[model samples]
Target: MNVLITGATGLLGREVFRAFQKNEWNLTGTSFRRKSPGLVRVDLSQPDTIHDFLNAHLPAVIVHTAAERHPDVSLRDPAGTRRLNVEATAAIASWAATHGAFVLYLSTDYVFDGTKPPYRPSDKPNPLNDYGRSKLDGEQELLSRAQKSSVILRVPILYGPCETLAESAVTVLADQMNRLTEPTLAIEDWATRYPTYTPDVAYTILQLVEYHLAHPDFHGIVHWSGNEGMTKYGMARVLAGQMGFPVERLVPNPAPPSGATRPKDAHLDCSALEELGIGRRTPFAEAIQAILHPA
Candidate 1:
């Protein structure tokens, strides 16, 4: 079967790329900025290019992972980000509908306001920031346009192998600690985060693809999250202990209230996906070990 992966060079997309290839699926990956050896250069921001590319090589399934994912960046350039995250996604879904291709959109927990402790797939979304709003818009687009052959997976904060060690959410703390000449590293303690492993996400996606093949009638939204609920302070402390850094070096930094509001707790309940036997998670400790010692 042919599988297409957008943002194939990104942190999560790269893992998904390897996972699909290992299963002997014919894979085609796309990248906008980076020119990877196996990836085809397709800019999602350009409607003409995206449409032409999808029409040329219509894959059986498209794992749409490409987007302007950074919240701060989205805030800075809302219009530019919306073009790719919202409009581009709508275009992709429209094309997929016409081409009879299944689209698996990788969404985020940011769709919620974060006041809720654990959100479900069926829960109504109330986004707080531009990034979250854009993602929510994209989700709506997929549901309305590609309703018959679309699956949305709402995920949480991710950390894993990337082109650089600093690209991951958890390992970035380690990188910051390594660069700090000071003995202290202040981390945000107010917000609760579910730091998921990218490899585990990749595994879950592969499982979902197989299940979709078997059960063509299945198409809806699902939730998948890491087992642990941690704050940045907690994650930094764990990383410090694991990496032999001074425990005292990590300090608590309360969440700020003035700027772009981030949800205090956007953790998801994966029971929906778990019930279908597709929500597989890696323990945070084991994931930390992998981050520390990458083979």
Candidate 2:
């Protein structure tokens, strides 16, 4: 029951690490730069290190969560981001295939153009930004190299415990509301999105891993998203209210101009995962409450 997780210090990966550890599984986690006490310092961008790390540890399952995630950052440094997002993923998948390991890659909902309302696992991907394109490419690389042994979980905007408010999208709303002195702050009014909780995603991943352990032949793509969809403006209002900030302070804004083209309504059809009896959707309001008042 050994599981190795990449990006173990990240917002999502941390939850996965804790979930597996809670179940008393042997866990090895990797970090790129920040030296967390328990994480192994392995730069996934380096193919040699990835190859060496996998060959040496050869965990039963590898949860690949490390990536260049910011759309703006990806647009600014395509080469640097691709090295980690696409190339490193390919190397890990190839190595895992040869070593008889199962890989669970965490992907994003941004792979779709917002023209579509609800995207399914079978739907074609039409990414709107370099970040999305890079993530889609990583998905392709892993599946191509390790088709029979890997599972791709396409997720939506994630929020969870982080060192700072700026780290999670939902919390960032509260941060903005807290800092703004003006009576009104503009929030994205047009684009529709689903905000998912990180711990719920970790729960889904663990279930998939348990199934994989029993059925090694099981391999395919599935998606998990929060059941609710709201525009960023709506989310801002909700978060503002919870934080005791006046809901009137939030104002609607047209989609902000950005170097990256973002999807307007990429709400995922998580029915595929739901049918599996493992995709437990978390309520956004409840998750926000927990974040606002962690017990």
Candidate 3:
């Protein structure tokens, strides 16, 4: 099967590319700037370019992991965010539908309002921020346009060794431990999301593709995330404990309201995914250890 993955140079995209490579799948990956072997430089912001590429490639599956994912960045440039996240996604979904190719769109837990915990796939989305709103737009576009051959997988805060945010957290804690000083603050009151190992998410995507191929009638939104939920402070503690870092380096605090308005709780329930036998939540500790000691 020929599979095309967009945003192949980003953290999650790179992991997905590696997984597909290991499986010896006929894969073509795309990036905007950085070029790698088997990668084509395609700008999602250009619908004509994207459409031409899709028509030429005619891939059996299109795994779209690209988007303006940063919440703050999205707030700063909402127009650009919509261009890439919403409009571009709609274009891709339309192209995929035209070609009769299965499209797996990566979504986020941010689609929830955070007023409720452990969001289900059936739950109505009430996005609190620009990033969430844009993603929700993409989800709706894909669902409404490519109803029969689309899968929307909403993920949480992804944590892995290669992930930029995860690595930043590790580096900050390590620096504090080296200095024998405690980190100033951790957002204890802000209950947010769990983390998904990149490889695990990629595996689940592959399973979704396989399921679609076999059933031929399966298509809809699916929730894929870690087994447990934790606050930012709790996740930090887990990282410290698993890495054998000094736990004293963590200081509990509340999220400041001056910055971006994040959902207080966005944990996703994967019961629908579990029913498919494709969503198995990886343990938080194990995921932490893997990040600490990547092989």
Compared with the true structure, model 3 gives a TM-score of: 0.91
- Measured by C-alpha RMSD in angstroms, how accurate is candidate 3? 2.4
Per-candidate clash tally:
0, 0, 0
Compared with the true structure, all predictions reach lDDT values of 0.88, 0.88, 0.80
How much is the lDDT of residue 109 in candidate 1?
A: 96
Model 3 scores a C-alpha lDDT of 0.80
List TM-score per model, in order: 0.97, 0.97, 0.91
lDDT of 3 by residue, 178-211 (tens): 4553345443546656767777888888788878
lDDT of 1 by residue, 69-180 (tens): 8888898999998999999999999999998999999999999998877898888899999999999999999999999899998898999876776887678888898898
For every candidate, C-alpha RMSD to the true structure in Å = 1.2, 1.1, 2.4
> lDDT tens digits, residues 131-217, model 2?
999999999999889999999999999998877889987788888887897878988887788889999999999999998888888
Which stretches of candidate 3 lie above 4 Å from their native place?
163-189, 256-258
